[model samples]
Target: MKLRIFHQTVYRYDRPARNLVQSLRLTPSVSEGQRTHDWQIDVQGGIRGPGFRDGAGDWIEGWTVRGPTEEVTVTVTGRIETRDTAGVLRGHRELINPLAYLRDTPATKPDQALRDLALTAKDAADPLGLAHRLSAVVSDAIAYMPGQTGFHTTAAEALEKGEGVCQDHAHALIALARLHDLPARYASGYLHTTADGDAHEAAHAWAEINVPGLGWVGFDPANRCCPDERYVRLGSGLDASDAAPIRGIAAGHGIETMDVAVSVEEVERFQTQSQSQTQS
Candidate 1:
C-alpha cells in the first residue's frame, strides 16, 4: 500500500526566542518492505543543516533559526510505499550491536511490577514466541487510555496504573523485554490505521526486539500485533524521548507551548496537475 503523511508541529513562545535549533528524525526507513517516494521537511525560515543516518539506521537532520519571533512551525509532507513484513525489520543498515539496546533508560526502567510481568513469558519455548506473548500480556495489563500518563511516566508506573497510551505500552514492553535478557528498544513512527485500530494519537510509537535470527522485529503492544503495511518505521531509541521525531531547544528564556497535528491516508487515484505517471 501507498500512503501520504502530513505532520505539522508549531511552537509558540510568550516572548521572542533569540535562537532555536532542532534535531529531526522524521524520514521513513527504506528496506525491502517499505520505500519512500518523496519527502520534505520545512522549518519556517530556518536554515536546514547537514543530515546523516545514525548507527540505529535512523536519518537525523539538523535545522537552526535565529529569530526575534514568537512562533515557529515545522511541516512535513511525504509519500511512501509499504508492505507487510510481519514486523520483521529486514535489510536495514545499522552499526550498533543488538546488545546495545539491552541497556535501560529512565523511561523504560522496570520495577517489581514489570519484572513480574516478564516472568509470565519466561517459560515460552522460543524467543519469537515469547516476544509475542509478552506483547499481548502488556496490552492486556494496560488498557489503551489516553490522558492517563505524561511524558515522564515510567513503564512500571504505567503498568501499575493499568492504562496508558501507545507510548506507555512501548515503554513497558521495552522494560519487559530487557528483564528477559532480550535486546529491545522504543520505536517512533507513523501508522495508517485500519477500521479496528486502537490508536493513541495521530503520531504513533511501538517497540522493537532483536531475536537471534531476526535483527529487529517490531511489536505494537497497544494494538496487539506486529507492524505491517499500515506502519512506517522512522527511528528507534532507548525510549520515546530519545526517539522523538523532533527535539529542540530555544536560546531565550521564554516559555514554550507546542501543538502537533498529523495525518496519514492511503493514496488512491488522483490526477496530478501535471498529468504525470503516479505509481508509488
Candidate 2:
C-alpha cells in the first residue's frame, strides 16, 4: 500500500523564548517492509543543521532557531510504499547490539507487578513465543483509555492503574519483555486509521522485541496486533522520551505549550483521481 502523511507541530510560548534547538527523528525507517519517497521536514524560521544515522539505524537531524521569538512550527510531509512483513524488521542496518536494549529507562522500569506479569508467560517455549504471549498478557491487563495516563507515567504505574493510551501500553510491554530477558525497545511511528470508527491514534507507538533469529519484531498491545502495512516505523529507543520524533529545548523559560496534528491516508484513491484528470 502507498501511504501519505502530514504532521504539524506548533509550539507556543506566552513570553518570548530564545535559542531553540531541536533534534528530529521524524524520517521513516529504511527496511524491506517500507520504502520512503518525497519526504520533507520544515521548521519555520529555523536553520537546518547536520544529519546522521544513529547507532540504532535511526535518522536524526538537528535544527536551530535563533529566537527571541514566541512561536515555532515543525512540519513534515512524506509518502511511503509499505508491505506487510509479519512485524519482522528486515534489511535494516544498525551498529548497536540487540542486548543493549535490555537496559531499562525510567518510563519502562519494571516493578513487582510487572515482574509477576512476565512470569505468567514464562512457560512459553521460545523467545518468539514468549514475546507474543507477553504482548497478549499486556493487552488484557491494560484498558485503552486516552486520558488515563501522562507522559511520565511509568510501566508499573500504568499497569497498576489498568488503563492508558498507546504510550503506556508500549512502555508496559517493553518492561515485561525485559523481565523475561527479551531485548525490547520502544518504537515511535504513524498508523493509518480507516473509516471504521476505530479509535487508533494516527501518531502511534509499539514495542519491538529482538528475538534470537528474527532481530526486531513489533507488537502493539493497545491494538492487540503486530505492526503491519498500515504502520510506518520511524525510530526506536529505550522509551518514549528517547524515541520521540522531536526533542528540543529553549534557552529561556517562557512557559511553552504545544499542539500537534497528524494524518495518514492511503494514496491510491488520490493517485487514481489524478490519473483520470490527466487523461480527460
Best by TM-score: 2
Question: lDDT of all predictions, in order shown?
Answer: 0.90, 0.94
- Tens digits of per-residue lDDT, candidate 2, 1-280, equal 8999999999999989888999999999999999998899999999999999999999999999998899999999999999999999999999999999999999998889998998999999999999999999999999999988889999999999999999999999999998888899999999998889888779999999999988899999989999999999999999999999999999886789999999998999778889999999
Clashes of 2: 0
- Write out the backbone clash pairs for model 1: none
CA lDDT, candidate 1, residue 125 = 93
TM-score of candidate 2 relative to the true fold: 0.96
Provide the lDDT at 264 for model 1: 86
Q: Deviation in angstroms for 22 in model 1?
A: 0.5
Worst 10 residues of 2 by lDDT: 192-201
TM-score of each: 0.94, 0.96
